[model samples]
Target: MTDALNAPGGLSRRRLLTAAGALGAVGLAAALSGCAADDPLAQQARAGDNKNYVAGDGSVTEYAKDTRKPPVDFTGVLYDGTKLGSKDLVGHVTVLNFWFAACAPCRVEAPELEALHTEFKPQGIVFYGVNLRDEQGTAEAFEQSFKLTYPSFNDKDGQVLLAMSGMVPPGAVPTTLVLDKQGRVASRVLGQLERGTLKTLITSAAAE
Candidate 1:
């Protein structure tokens, strides 16, 4: 999980292919296309055999169905001290990711969360970060350091965590909740997401 995805001057797949095509001229234009067509989450799936994300006592579980709906109104405060409420994200699929900067698994899954944010933003998907047990500076810096575009709500008092304890464990960090347009919990990935699973779940939830 410690690959240098932030490599200096490291060519993104697109950039590398673009440079290749520029040198190749028109001979391989179509060949260079569809580079990211395959699932980006493929790597995580391959690394699945590396770790067991199962929780003790089977307390954490994934939501296997899409029938659950969110409340009509919800509200919270973001890390930047901005107010965010349910009405702001109404009629869109919203993903709430709960994490802390100190958690190693949370760091491992951060990139995938950013990727999902970029991939599904234009598709009517909304992402909200819930920084649990985190300081305002650390949470803000984490978002900035990762280039994460989604706004995060600080759970310094764990108010949101207490509210969601019935559906999610209060001890669970890096928990992801998928909510339908109406603000209902559609699906939840209790632990780290296997790369593309987050994006896929968001897309499916949006379509639902």
Candidate 2:
């Protein structure tokens, strides 16, 4: 396991195992106490409606430079078969969006994400989609339909997701994370991204 998986205050193996088990009222209350009442993950778990995805409230969190955790560590192959790792993201501002083709919020924000990619790529900012579920053909079709220029990772087996489990909620589709030049998470957006908000976040990360 990488540091990202074992970072302080992050999800631990025991917690994950507990989360994977049945959540009765007492268990649900315990989980909710660990996070904010409105936290999408906890809220979704409480709903018990089998929605299969958490619809965040578009919350944005920016970590101060000093408060940021250690640089993230993980590795995965891109949809195009290019291997990438956290080390590769060092010295550049990077954005990672978690999504799947079936996610309605993901579809809604695709153009905005692509637009941001176009605007910032010239400035050396990077963007990648951490696709949670979808076969190659389905993912490819979604990309083609959106005319997305960036490549997504085929994370169906969830290596990328597992590595990022500390930072990202397990089933929060359409979450976006911005990493600073040092590969530490700088900012995060949970839910459908707002173009201006994300643009500002990218700009700030790039400036740092």
* Window of ten residues with lowest summed lDDT in model 2: 19-28
Residue 145 shift from truth in candidate 1, angstroms:
2.2
Model number with the top lDDT: 2
lDDT of each: 0.60, 0.74
| TM of each candidate vs. truth | 0.67, 0.75
lDDT of 2 by residue, 89-135 (tens): 89999999999876766765676678778989999999999998899
User: Lowest-scoring 10 consecutive residues by lDDT in candidate 1?
Assistant: 28-37
**C-alpha displacement of 196 in model 2, angstroms?**
0.1
After TM-score superposition, what is the CA distance of residue 189 in candidate 1 from its true location, in Å? 0.4
Model 1 lDDT tens row, 1-208: 0111222443452354344334433322222223212323323322453232333121122343333434635567888789877778768888888877655456556666776678788787888888877788888776775567888888778777776756667666568877777777766676655444455456656766
